[model samples]
Target: MSATRRQMLARTGAAGAGIAFTGAISELFAGTAAAHGRAGYGPLVPDPKGLLDLPKGFRYQVLSREGENLRSGEGKVPSNHDGMAAFGGKRGGVHLVRNHENRVTAKIGVPTVKGLTYDPAAKGGCTALALDRRNNVIGERVAIAGTAVNCAGGPTPWNTWLTCEETEDKAGTNGYTKDHGFIFEVDPVDPHRTGAEPLTAMGRFQHEAVAVDPRRGVVYETEDAFQKPFGLFYRFLPKKPQGGRGSLRAGGRLQAMRVPGIPDLSSIQEIGASFDGVEWVDVPDPLAVRTPIRHQDFGPKGVTHAQKLEGCYWGGSSVYFVSSFARKAEGSAGDHYGQIWRYDPSRRRLTLVIVFGPSTDIQLPGESPDNICLAPAGGLMVCEDGGGVQHVYGVTRRGDVYAMARNRQNIGTPDNPEWGEFAGAAFSPDHDTMYVNCYAPGTTFAVTGPWHR
Candidate 1:
């Protein structure tokens, strides 16, 4: 590890909310004209492989590619690779559990096996991969099957992965025989033991992502609906997560967040404006049959609104979440790329750590910050799901944002490349490899470099 990185971790503790208050581009990425790259580790050198472009000393290799046969050889690797989590393998290397955000009529889905599915009619689920310490894929298989829109999820300190359904589709709705929109757990310690069960107590809404507090077993959830109606920031205090892996199913209390004095907190349009003394409102019924739990159950009860709460991560002792693209288009009051908020459970305080305003520049320091992973070296690595050319932004505990890697791949055409949204950004437990997914064509890359530098 570099001395510079060690100092950053020691000075700014991740346990509490720390942020770099500057909007300046990362000095590390200021590229010189001759090298066609920026400072930091050096400007990103264009990849001759035409997959990913990285800085001078760094390189990336495709870990998993779409259209490939599964390790079990039942179905092809599902497309629409969304959120993911990385864990230290039981034997060696890294174990990553990934989510496939498939819909009912999707062409590719998780392999359906007997005695291991929730709703066979549902097409979305999660898959697990085992990679060697060299970042080579050793094995891959389905972890959880038969769910819907398995979007973003977080890894538990207990060595399991929590995969969430982003849909509120009920059993009878859209040909689904079973109700959807619930959180599912996948144990990497034993993949076959991962059954098709939803943590129903978490609530049924347009679920986005979840962050589990390692100490208290409190699960922080985000809702991803349109902005006008907005979504709620939720917390599920598992009654007995002490039972381990599937304990959340034992039942828990579900609640929505509220700013003490604000009815619609989504409209608060200020960067770095802190809201202390955050309160929680209990939700009477989390499983809504006729309407979404957010629209009908909590809207009228003064629960605060968040335009589109997407990716969230639990680290140190707080939950960090991204409100992606809050604009009038999504029904939110104002327009901006995104906002990052931190909620400290112990203090009951919520801080607006970082906000990205309007920007057309593809190389801007901060864009749409989504899908966050707190690296072991200390600092948040964010996935960008916004428009234009995209890159993963590295954030300090104090909220200083910098360009870590840029996407130079061509999707639409060579003349007009649309950098697809970056998702599933997680660093390996050893900190030697960082795995992230490109939404289009569904590609997962193993990134390694002097991350400590």
Candidate 2:
């Protein structure tokens, strides 16, 4: 009768649900990499040495760093950097919206402007940085006040940042408001405004990143819960068309995905293989109504639990999503370490675009891909979440991959570099400038590339 019980019955048959106490296991355990077929692709480019390295003529410079003294007298830099977006710029100058993924850190001192402390541990959140024509930090301000674990988020068409909290526990461990997981709208210019509120209409979940569909007022969200079944990939369609401009408080429709014709669990295992093919069924009304088939249903058969779905963007006619981990099987030619999938609205299908890392035989050795962005030169730029060598990777539309820049800090060893993981890749309106964030050290970099065809 309940959602969980219905799902269990659907997977193991009505009769199997009663066998739980009879020592009969209805679930099948398969190796993580055994599902999904290989997608075709070759290596793109070798890793880079400098903080950022692009094709000839392209160069990058640090716009802001954690612990750096800001013009506002805020001593030291911010940590746990993530999602970023550039707005209101012409040629070289612009305003940047960035997220600080720190939940609680005694070293940073609760980030408050002047004499205000929203919480004893309000350090983890989002910030607004003003940049000059040359991509230099002129000023920085805390955009969305009193939020935690502000991770990867997308830019709205109306010029605002949708900062998402990566945790679900609102009543966080220390009895602090627990504002770790939820979506918040931040205005870069007036970040410190007292009326800013969290949008509970987005539904409370372990939100990782979000992408807004400007045309439809639809918000596509990704979750990062691994242990509790597969995380759900959701879409929030505001009740009133074009209603989510400066506020996400208006309730909306939330929907998940189903595999459609795949009646048996075994068929679900075959869906992740080849990228060129495969279809996804959209489960309408995931938040409002209960459905027997959910995204987590596919996890037992090696599916990356839809919760691992991270970054997303509206590219071409479809929306593309990135999976941080989807390793290949023991003897498969194509590796599944990670993959880029596209959801075609017109065709109502999902397709694999690029496969990264050794599993796909595409990445060098240890390249775990994360937040991605569309390049001005017609390609996708992916941030590496791996070791000391974490760098930004460029994958052309033609499937050719290359390393765009390095994270500047080595995360693999004990030294544990200060710079965090490179993430939230976004280009200026003109595509001439690229802005990236380091997740660990919580720093932001602005780079100018030589535009060459």
Best by lDDT: 1
lDDT tens string, model 2, 342-439? 56555566544444443222222224667887666554567877644566766443333455665555444656444457888888876678888876
lDDT of 1 by residue, 262-293 (tens): 65555664545678789888887888866676
- Misplaced by over 4 Å in model 2 are 1-56, 90-92, 113-120, 192-195, 261-307, 327-335, 359-366, 411-420
**Model 2 poorest ten-residue lDDT run:** 25-34
Cα lDDT of all candidates, in order?
0.74, 0.57
Deviation of model 2 at 141, angstroms: 0.9
- Top model number, TM-score: 1
- Cα error, residue 423 of model 2, in Å, equals 0.8
